[model samples]
Target: MAAAPGLAPDAPLHIVSNAGSGSKDAHEARQQIEAILTAAHRPHEFILIDNPGELARVAKQAAEAAVRSDGAVVVAGGDGTINAVVQAVLPTERPFGIIPQGTFNYSSRAHGIPLDTREAANALLTARPKPVQVGMVNDRAFLVNASLGLYPELLQDREAYKRQYGRRRTVAMWAGLKTLLREHRQLIVEVEHEQGSETLFTPSIFVGNNALQLEQVGLEEAEDVKRHRLAAVIVEPVSTTELVWLGIRGMLGRLGDDERIRDFPFRSMTVRLLSSGKKRTIKVAVDGEIFWCEQPLTFHVAEHPLSLLTPTTVK
Candidate 1:
């Protein structure tokens, strides 16, 4: 692990620590950060945002601070909290710095930030920030991919399932397989790709700006699987029996280059919850955080994206 990046001699920084949302050793990590800052002779302010609805407010304050001091806005939390700050943030004078302390911190991990708090903090302090694309669902910022149908359903029971199974959480995968077998629910997904408009009945759909390549896919490199286009994929099943087989296939990571599972690249995609009311309520999960919102959900790539400091050279 390295020390926190030295500020421009006597630079000011604003740190907003999300309360009750990080790993168990957050306090010790903060102490380490404070010690580093003190040793570097850098002046900083630490605000523990603990009140309800205070995250967004504090985020805005941090952004404003970044603008005023021309320094960095640093956040310590999990994926959801990170997503909240990313969404709330505006283009500022300084870049955003992150320390991953949440469950499934894939964004941080994907960017090559260390899972350990102190190591990641050190990397952020020293590394050069790189610009990366950010996705917007109806103008809501997201760091990773978004999903519909079975994903929302599966994630809905994630907490309950996690608690019940604990270390044996693979049970959720089995349960999802069972849901696929017993419940023959099909969603009417209308996708407007660069080619044209096509509607299909899918069990689930994923709108991805990037793809996590698995070994079953037979790829050594997990490069920019996503480009200016979004990947729309469906794991379609012919019947209830076939649905179970498909789930098993997906779980075993065996379904690769199959016709039933297709990926379409598009610059934009819109999803409408067909059965829902005027409110257009659909469960949308972005970067592992779930929320209920009505659709037609509009997703597009943001023009001016943030600079994510990562270990990789790829933008």
Candidate 2:
């Protein structure tokens, strides 16, 4: 594992955030965070990006300012915003102090940061950026896996359902069920790895650099990046019955015993679009944020420690 970056006792702190992204109630979240930080008596500055595509520019500028002033930055936004900042400041010594503001903050969840924005901000004072693992896909940094499957469909329908019936769990579940019935097509993925290769005919494949530490698995106290290796599981359900059965089993933690979830673990894997007679494209979701992309998404582990603040360590 690489040595964790050193933090100064008086390193200048900056908070980067978008005021409005998820859940309309978060309109005042930035202001609230600032207030909490001020109350904590921490020396800090807050920089807000008013519009889209400005996050990268603002982050670069802030990073430069930090360099000139000898400081660090704390980001308060959703997963996409965090991804943007991380991507913008790659290979630089600028460490990110993350503040979760997204619907499902996967990065924070992976790092064991507090879920509540207010609590997460306060935890910054005591927490140090520990040496943690990161995943890189074609040079794009992602805290979680780049996934294609029913996950993307469920996200689309979930949003539409939210429009009809405000953020209710039952409505989201119904929407997912309806989407599953409509889209029953299988996806064929040809996977290439360092040692060998294989083909899979399934609904989707989730190539994970980091196993999700929230909901399904608990966080580990000391995640030694050097000792651990990246794992990928390709879904291969031939029939609807098999899909449903395997999905339930996976969700119930029985996936270790299910054949479909068992695949070779590789240090790196590239998935190519292999559908014939059609323009092969799929909606990819990285850490719960969705985007459309063509074939051949690469997945591999990158060793880097993201500077973050947390109240206490959980294993």
Among all candidates shown, the one with the greatest lDDT? 2
- Best prediction by TM-score: 2
In candidate 2 the C-alpha lDDT for residue 242 amounts to 71
Error of 2 at 141 (Å): 1.0
Model 2: colliding residue pairs: none
TM-score against native, each model: 0.80, 0.81
By summed lDDT, which 10 consecutive residues of candidate 2 come out lowest? 217-226
Worst 10 residues of 1 by lDDT: 213-222
Model 2: per-residue Cα lDDT over 156-245, one tens digit each: 787798788866546765666666555467777787898778787778776555556322422221132234556566666656667666
In the range 41-118, model 1's lDDT, one tens digit per residue, is 667777677853788888888878767886777777766677777765535525666778766566776667787877
Error of 2 at 158 (Å): 2.9
TM-score between candidate 1 and the true structure: 0.80
- Give the C-alpha miss distance for residue 284 in model 2, angstroms: 2.5
Error of 1 at 275 (Å): 3.1
Alpha-carbon RMSD to native, per candidate = 4.8, 3.7
